[model samples]
Target: MNLTTTAKPIVIIGAGIAGVHAAETLRNEGYEGRIVLVDRDTQLPYDRPPLSKEFILGELSEADISLRSNESLTALRIELKLGVEIVSIDAKKKIAISSDDEILEWEKLLLTTGSSLRKLQVKGSDLEGIHYLKTLSDAKAIRQKLDGIQQVAIVGAGFIGAELASSFKKQGKEVTILERMPLPLAHILGEEMGEYFLQLHQSEGVHVITEDAVVQFDGTTQVEKALTEKGRIIPCQAVIVGIGVIPNTFLSDKELHVDRGYIVNEFGETSLPNVYAAGDCAMWPYRGDNIHIEHWDHAVNHGKCVAKNLLGGEPISYTAIPYFWSDQYDHRIQYFGHTKNWDSAVLQGNMEDKQFTYFYLNESGVIDAALLVNQPKNALAVRRLIKQQQSVDSDLLSNPEVNLKNVHVQENEDKVSY
Candidate 1:
């Protein structure tokens, strides 16, 4: 958590939450080095999740999204370069070439370019009325178009699409979500729990359409309707695609082993020395799989761990349990750890009751992954189970009479929710 070094110019690309926080953490760690922050956006780093939720709901404004005030940025004595893009990185030369044709050599480079929203590969996708939420400008565009809008079609049933549907429904918009999979959130939460989400959205009065692909958009000059694979037409003034995201790595070449995202080790180190990648753009090992996490918390935490490595700290591997959450309507869904390797599941509480935690247990009886709906407290013990590799008794997990407080499912049951 502490980094103190006299390194000459630490350059951070993409002023996102990860980049900004890493810089802040560096200063907190007593490091008095020069931190130059570069970003392609005109505005400073802001929260992206609220853009589809509270921001669109009118509970928060654009300014509320800013992570730090002008005073804070100025007082930090950090160089802020906004609306600038990094053209490429010469790792061997330890220099970063900017779009404006300025090359700055860095003692250490932190790449945090983040992810780009995946676009619908359908016709009329380039139309004016279609949008995706990935940046402040994107959120602004959608908010402007939402004036008196009646119907909104959201493509994909992932976190972003689901959250948007919830927000749109709250704003009295006729929200319809279309998913190509038979079950919503199947790849993330599994089909059983994905259907539960389908029911959850349906109960909230949102039209949940599954097993349907948006074939094309219908309009002359702008998007007026959505043409589904089922040959059904849904009237809409706007369409938001939230299928997922692709890593933004146009600047880096194979010298860093860039796949969809930059490939990194357990400590967030890339193939090139003195260069580290974090957040959505870096792929690290997850449950024996080299995966890229797109969640905000993961990005922030990864930034901290990577900063430690860059500051000449002890060899600490970046190995936090992967976790993600989604706020849809009045319900909040949070998942932790891996589920793909689980052979069995222990269900606690009633899905019909709409408040329960489903824990996926591996053949070894250790809780591998968990999905919690409405109940936020369950993630506390479940995360423990995942870390400790403890053998779970199905009765203790599923039985309402059984006290989980006395039972240690993970390494430590006393650990609380984050």
Candidate 2:
């Protein structure tokens, strides 16, 4: 449907970073049709990445992270239906029925429902003091309770888990990280970078426990202690589970091709036509890696691509150079690209000084992925090599004498891979 002519209003089924930007992009792209936003959250669309870091650290507020203002929504004529759950979908009829019998019709539907944190199924899982930083309310409750507590046990040492550890330590809480992995953040950042991260947290007075499994929780009602596989019972007043989030695709039907995330094509079109998906909830082509990321930048770029494609423009496939950032223990960690089975890792600079870049390369000496801790400018260059899938001189990439600025990204026409 050409939006310039008479077009049915676009219906967005989320108020997350993906849905919010998708609706906002439609207006910026000059679509005058009414925009209807359906969300399960009562608060308006706000950034989620900051919730675990800056918001918990007492640096940024809930209002500061919002992408759109009341003025912006007023000028755009966006209709918000908050605290409503979509009951069922009749895609053939182009109509969605909600729990309140509020049926919505649309020319197109964008599913940006995002994700939910994976809950630990152990005992004391439903304890009151336990929390997960996925929503605004979750952050608020955790922040309110943090002041009274001095000891905290965090499970899963991923970005969210590590950031929470950093934030709590700043609040004078004794943070203990319980990670099942031998090295912290090994999957994405590799061993060298992960080791540096482990030291960084420990140097800041945070206790680090590795290769330990939580066999059980010892508490009557609230989580008071966690028993480890090594037979260590650690005392704690509060617990935060950061095991990671699973894409909210429970509402998707068989035609949608749901994996960990809703599978979409290059244009953000699902298996069904006229139905698009984006953000943390959606997965598109990565390079030749068959990888998927839930990064903030990826969500924003994918939403914009969907908006442009919906505008009736001859769709150009989107190939994003994956870039993501994290803040932990006063260090800014930025990573680029998907590293699949790297054969060698080359490090530049000193880890003890808290500044370095680690390059993940294949056996043939091509830079598949790279991560920078406290090196912001180097992140941009590393992103280029990984995106282009270009080869690098192993001698130069490993040598400390070579300048990273001399690196040039190959300009091949890269295709989006699923």
Candidate 3:
């Protein structure tokens, strides 16, 4: 069935960066069909990255981080449904039942339901002061309670945890981080770079305890202390958990292929016809691997790419480079491309100077990914090199004097695309 010819609305669940971008793309691409953008969140779609940093630091307001204004969404002719959960989807009938039992029939369904925060089920988790930051409301609650918070304990030393540590320390609160890994971010950035970040926190006066997991939280009415697996006790008036998130796949039908996430092909098409998925909830094919990236850049590009395919003409494969950034204290961290494994990580510039880049090279010396610390100028060049998939001289990549733009060999069409 040609989706454009149908009068039924194109229903997109989850009004996040992905869903909002998809809705706008549909309209901008000249699709005249009705569009419905739904989300359980009542607030207008807002940028999430700041929730851990600027939002907590009071540098950026709730209105400042909003992705789109009400007026913009209205002008696009997109129907906004807030505070409504998509309870169930009837694949055969092409209908969605919401939490209110309202039915929405669609010519094509796009699942951008995104991901949910992974909760720590430790004892005393229900205590009043323990928090998880995933939404604007979560940040607001934390901010409102900050005046009474003196000591803050952060669980999990991931991006959220690290950023929270930076923010809390800046707020003049005694901050402590509990990480299960001996070296935080070692799983992704390798131990060398991880140690650099671990020190980054310590240098800023934040206490970090590694190789320890929070087994329990203890308090009377509110969390006053955290008990770790290593028998260490951390005292804190407030605790923030940022272990990571699980892809929201509750609305997915059994007929839809599901792996770590809702599985989609290159064009974001799911197993069921007229049904598609993207963003954090959808895992797409990349370099012969099915992967899910939970980041703003990927979501925005993925949503737009999928929207074009939904218009029913020549299909476009989703191949945008995966990117994500983090702000910790005064440092700006930017990473481009994605790779689970690399033959080597070549470090250029000095970490002690607080500015450097780590290039991950494949077995054939091709640049797979790069991590830039306070070196925003090298970002565009690194991205171009990774996408080109051309071999680079390790000597040149490791030298601080060498320009990254001049470090690559001629691009080969036969190389594997990122």
Number of the predicted model whose lDDT against the real structure is largest: 3
Model 3 accuracy (lDDT, Cα): 0.91
lDDT of 3 by residue, 1-79 (tens): 1444578999999999999999999988888879999999899999998898888889999889999999999999999
TM-score winner, 1 or 2: 1
**C-alpha RMSD of candidate 3:** 2.2
**How well does candidate 1 match the true structure in TM-score terms?**
0.94
Write the residue-wise lDDT of candidate 2 on 1-418 in tens digits: 3566345678888888878788888888888888888998888778888898888877898889887776778778888888988867667888888888888888888888888888888866777788888888999999888778888999998988888888888788888999999888877776766787788888888888999978777788878898898998889989888888888886666677888888888888888767888888887886554456788998898888887777786885778877799888768888877766788888887676767788888886678778887888787667766766656766667666667777665456332211
| lDDT sort, best first | 3, 1, 2
Task: Provide the overall lDDT of each model, using Cα atoms, as 2-decimal numbers.
Answer: 0.83, 0.80, 0.91
Worst 10 residues of 2 by lDDT: 409-418
- Model 3 residue 250 CA deviation (Å) reads 0.2
lDDT of 1 at 318: 88
lDDT of 1 by residue, 200-289 (tens): 889989888888899899898878999998898989988998888899888766677888888999988888888888998998987688
Worst 10 residues of 1 by lDDT: 409-418
lDDT of 3 at 400: 89
TM-score of 2: 0.93
Superposed by TM-score, candidate 3 places the C-alpha of residue 291 at a distance from the truth, in angstroms, of 0.6
In candidate 3, which residue pairs clash? none
Pairs in clash, predicted candidate 1: 384-410, 385-410
